[model samples]
Every structure is written in structure tokens, then in C-alpha cells.
Target: MSKMDIYRRSQFFISPPAILKVIEVLILVTAMILFLVDNKCSGDLAFVTIFVLPCVVVALATLISYISAVFVLVGRRNPLTTPTWVKGDVWFNIVSLVVMLVGSILTLTNEGCANNSLTVASIALGFISVILFAISGAVTYLVLVRHQQEVKEAQRAQLNTRRVTMSELA
Candidate 1:
């Protein structure tokens, strides 16, 4: 990343991931409402209900994601955020994103559901969620990758220091 990119990213009130977490929660909630309304009006309630299931599941996932974000954002001593938790977060985002994209595709192609404004809006929100989830996953993955790199650099520096000290002694 460029200096500007890093600068802009770190300048936010909270971290980008935290901001995204809140946005994701809002988007999921909105999508759920839109999906529910669209499904309710689609005639054949039983059949349309199936299409709304993914949104419901995604909403629940958003809740969990939000909690995890909070844990990470909390002041020092927050035990909820370990490397293990970040790995889980990345996996969860990947899975939920796929589920949401599939649901959006299904909703769009379902003949029973009318292609009304609400339906389109719901699908749009789903796409937005997919993008956000993908971004969050990438960011978390990068964090892990960068930490490994930092560790390697530290080890190398320590080794160099030791070599310099030994040569000076000789």
C-alpha cells in the first residue's frame, strides 16, 4: 500500500474494519426488511418464504460479526480478539458472503417473486454486503500476513545484531 492509502486508512475515528462492521450490520438489517416485505407480497407465501431464509441467516451472522468487531475494538485486555478469532472472522465472512450472493441470485431469478422496487433494492443490498464481506476478509487476512512478515523481520534484525556483536568481540 502507498503512504496515502495507509494514511487515509488509519485516519478514521475507528479502524476501517470496525466501521465496516457497523455498516454491514445496517445493510443486513435493511436487506432483511426488504426481503421480508418482498416475500410477503409475492403471493404464494410458502414458496416465497424459502427465498427469505438466507437473509434471516445473514442478519444473524451480521449480529455475530458486530459482536466480534466490538471485541476487537475494545480497549486493551479484550480477550475476545486472538489470532484464532481473526481466522474465524475471515472464514465466517467468506461463507456468509457466498451465502448472501447465492440468495440474491435466487431471489432475482425466482419467478414467484415479483421484480418490484423492493426486491431490486434488496438484491442491491445483498451485493453491497458481498463486497463488504470480501473486503473485511481480505483486510483481516492481510493483517495476519503482515504480522508474520513483521515477525520475520524482527528475527532477522535480532540475528544481525548478534552477528555484529560477535564480530566486534572477535
Candidate 2:
């Protein structure tokens, strides 16, 4: 296989969630910068309410989803066959969706606040939450892929050994 093919087959390969996490981090940083730079730019109350508030809500929701996923993954209540990683991922996605819904509602109802700095900080936090959500997703996928690869390797080794023993007997 080519290098790309080998990478594709690897169990420990990077996953979508991992990539998302990186994205989240970047978004959070951007939000922080915006807050720092424009702390006094909140006079346009309508603009802040319509734009910044929604972003803040989104970030918060994403963060919650990320936490939920982590909880599912780390919980030790299930058997080996239960695939905790996958379960965690499912829960994370569900929670994330719910958070997003809540955020949307909040965004719609947002009224501009007097404290521009606080508003900016809230938006920054929202970005941070999204980053966490992405990371959770990536980690879950990586775990699952690794487990599957290990199983396949074990099975292949067993079959090879069997073939050698049969040949020796003959």
C-alpha cells in the first residue's frame, strides 16, 4: 500500500473529532482576541445582540456536548463488548445537538447588555465550548478504529499459526 493507504488503515489515525477540536481551539482564540480588542464596541446594541450573543450561546452548547462525551467514555459501567468509545460518541453528538438547540433559543431572545466586555467574554467562551466538542468527537473515532485494528491483527495472526501447524502435520 502507498503511504496514504497505510495511514488510512491505521487504528490510531486522527479522526474527525480530533480535527474538530483543533478548529474549536482556533475559534476560541479568535473570540478571545475579538473580546480584548473591542471591549468598548458594544454601543451598537442591536448588532451585539444579533451577532455576538448567538456565537456565545453556540460556544457554550458545544462545550457542554464535549463534556457529556467525555463522561460517557470514562464511565466504567459497561462490559468490554459494549464499545464505550462509540457509546460516548453517540451521547456526545446527542448532547451537542441539544446544546445547539438551547443556544439557538437564547440567541433569538438575546437583548443587548450594557457591559461590552462581558458580552465579548461570553462570546469567547462559546468558541471554547465548540473546540471541546470537536475534540471529544475525534478521540471517540480514534479509539474505535484502534480497537477494530487490534482485533483484525489478532485474528490474522491466529489464522497464520493454524496454517503453519497444518502444514507441519502434513
Candidate 3:
């Protein structure tokens, strides 16, 4: 890669991978805060409820995704060669999107079950987390899809070139 390309790739603002990493961190922070605050106001229901469990799971997934993003974006590692658990690949984004969607809906619905400042704040933050996760997931998926198309095009071009060269030789 050119120096400019490397610089752009390494930058969080300019790099798609880095942007996804930052979004994962944002989601993690917001979801964790929401979970903690909700736990405080939610009494025993927080620990026992189905909704709260998913919030915790979303927080954990975001945390893992953030760590994986660091390896891929900052360390300049290839996600394709890495283990699925340690890479922010297409599947991870899809799973994160689904989890965030469900978690956000659960959090939003649970808002009606309680009445307090903290609970309301938790729900608001949950929405923010969901938005961030959705953006990250969608962008990641699109980028990967486009990348696959480009790779296929390159392969097809090479194959056609080889066929033409062989026919000419014949």
C-alpha cells in the first residue's frame, strides 16, 4: 500500500474498520451503563428478567467485538485468517446486529414496566447503543459485500486473460 493509503487505513476517522471498532466501543459503553443503571432501579427483576439478560449479553458481545476490532484495525491483522471469536468479520457483525436489535427492543419495552429517572435514562441510552450497533453492523456488512464483489471481478479478469493467452498460443 502507498503511504497515504496506509495512513488512511490506520486512521479511525478515515478507516471503515476503525470506525466499526469505535462504534463497537460506543455500543459497549452505552449498553453497560444502561445495564448497571437498570439493575439498580429494577430490583430483583433486573437479575431475573429475560430482558436484562439479553442486555448483559449485548454488552459482552460488544466488548468482544471491540477487542477483535483492535486486532484487525489497529494491529493491521487480517480477519480472514483469524479465528471467528477474535475477528470482526461479516458473521460477527450480523450476529451483533441481531443481538442489538433484540436487546434494544427488549429494553425499550421494559421502560413501561418501571417508573423512575434512572430507568428512563437507561432506556434512552439503550436506544443510543442500539443505533450505534445498527450502524456498525450495516456498514460492516455492506463493506464486506462490496469487497467480495471486487475480489470476484478480479478473479474473473485473471481467468479471462489466461484463456485468451492460451487460445493465442494454440
Top candidate when judged by TM-score against the true structure: 1
Model 1 TM-score, 2 decimals:
0.76
Tens-place lDDT per residue, model 1, 18-90, is 5676788788778878877645444766545544676678777867876765555463322122467668878
lDDT of 2: 0.51
lDDT of 1 at 114: 46
Please tell me which predicted candidate would have the highest lDDT against the true structure. Answer: 1
lDDT, residue 57, model 2: 58
Ranking by lDDT: 1, 3, 2
> How does each model score on lDDT?
0.69, 0.51, 0.56
Model 2, 1-170: lDDT tens digits are 43223223231224455346446545644654564465454365554444445445555554664455445445632111236645655565456545534443453344443246555454546535644665565566555676568779989999999999999999
User: Model 1 residue 106 lDDT?
Assistant: 70
**Prediction 3 global C-alpha lDDT:** 0.56
Displacement of residue 136 (Cα, Å) in model 3 is: 2.5
